[model samples]
Target: MKKFAVIALTEGGAQTARCLQEQLATQGFKVEVILPQRLAREREIYYRKGDFNSTMHRLFREYNCVVCIMATGIVVRALTGVVVDKTVDPAVIVMDEKARHVISMLSGHVGGANEWTRLIARLMEAEPVITTATDTEKVQALDVLTKKVNGWYPNFKENTKKINRRLAEGKAVELFIEPYLEKYVEQFNGFTLIRDIESHRGGTPLVIVSDHTGFAKNADIIHVVPQLNVLGVGCRKDVPIAMMQTAFTEFCQQHQLLWQSIVKVASIDVKKHEAAIQYLAKTLNADLEFYTAKELQKVSQKYPESAFVLKTVGVGNVACAAADYASGEQNVTQRYANHEITMALSRLHEI
Candidate 1:
């Protein structure tokens, strides 16, 4: 179920969230409502925040997406001091205290503002205000991987054209979405929608979102994507894991990278393999590792953050560094694991 954190500005905001929660419950989404203390005059509210900072600190750390009963930007801005976790930044949705339309306010693309809005709109028979580029496009039916779209993925340049061409042709197309991705439906459309193991009839076009291989046998399900990128980082000495994380996030955004694209976390043996790195990786369902030092020195192209630990572990940095390097060729574009993880994605082309 798509998880949502409903945050209300006032007592009535909390109650509004409750009504929406009951409605969303029927649609199969996990919903939790957050509110301030003694806001509602009539109804006895269960939730109350003592220290606003700590309350939000714990909440963002736990939830995937947050739906604000009102404007939540202030709450989010205030919590910046304590909690820095965005691993599961709740797709922020704004609903009125009057229980009007559910408006997706932030994280529209990946956090699922679009699909959640569509679902709520359907339930309430209200209009879903979707403000996204990809959703309003003319999509084609084709076997194309769902690449993370923080910006232009040079590798996807080829695949995008193919999807457009297929779309232009009027050939029947089928879209495949991860059942778990139900929350993101509104952000995307135009392609035919399909659930797991569900095959399409005849030669319809297919779009897919899977972390593994072998989705459907028919040419109908055209693409299979790992749908995430695994980042194996080796920072220089004493580069606090916090700094590493901050820097990495900046690098990704600067590169228009998708936070979801990073699945696994990695580091070299010399770094003591700290908890912060593991925490960041775990948030993305990725494992943490400390490879031999020498292994990294070799794949110097993607340098490991070299430290004295290299002297402790005998191996060179080559292995760990090579672990980060990808074949410059666009065909080597898939990730969710280290380059050495050995994936047979080529089979996707067989159909």
Candidate 2:
């Protein structure tokens, strides 16, 4: 569940916070109210008697998003020492005491403050104060697009503001799309499709949509990797996380696959609780799925088998079978295994 922190100081702010908590709860948010010592009433209120800034700092570290129903100046001053990078910072929104306006204060784009602002404003019938250039200009934001298509932005730390500024100025951007995504390119504006690399002239921001990795990087190029790959992993119970990471990276690099394109890490149900595989999945922010030995046996790929593996796990080919089951693809990479771990990859067709 999405966690939300609502900080309120006054009686009027507490009333607004309660109303917002009810509305947001219906939409599946876990909203918690943080109140000053004197204003605490309900059992749910987190009453802090000491410094407000310290309380806010702790809340900012704990919650996914924070809403302040107080003066904008107060919110800004309270967060001065706790603010971090946009990619990792939690979304922060400020609302007027009367709920007449909702402002997206920080982490508007990547952290989804702008989107939350719109949702809260619509629910409360208040005016949304979005100051982001792309939002104000109605330009399609790159971060939003990447999230929608399950793509990864490799150079977001370096190139986000530059690309958004170009788009805000209505400058044309160049897009290199895989044939499967050609039909969907019309949804974006200010983009000219480049059919061939030789035919491309270089005067605009570039977006490349593909599953390959290590494309040449330029200041203007943004590599968008679609989440089209699934990895089936088999490992000894005591395999180390570092060894798994090395094996996974080498496999992707050898196959020319983008490590970021991996959407799921699959394995037999018995190895579902393996720490190394779980750590790898958490690092990629992908789903970890486990299939029963019976379910894996149903996949009819002609994978190489081991009698010892079959005797141990009831499936002769764990990696290939799990990959086929997870990605619904018959093709798989050759088994790449170290002494401790085994991995195979499968690519899914574009939707």
Name the candidate that leads on TM-score: 2
Residue-wise C-alpha lDDT for candidate 2, range 91-147, written one tens digit per residue:
999998899999999989877899899999998899999998888888867776565
In candidate 1 the C-alpha lDDT for residue 196 amounts to 46
- Model 2 local distance difference test score: 0.82
TM-score of each: 0.41, 0.75
Model 2 TM-score on a 0 to 1 scale: 0.75
Residue 322, model 2, lDDT: 85
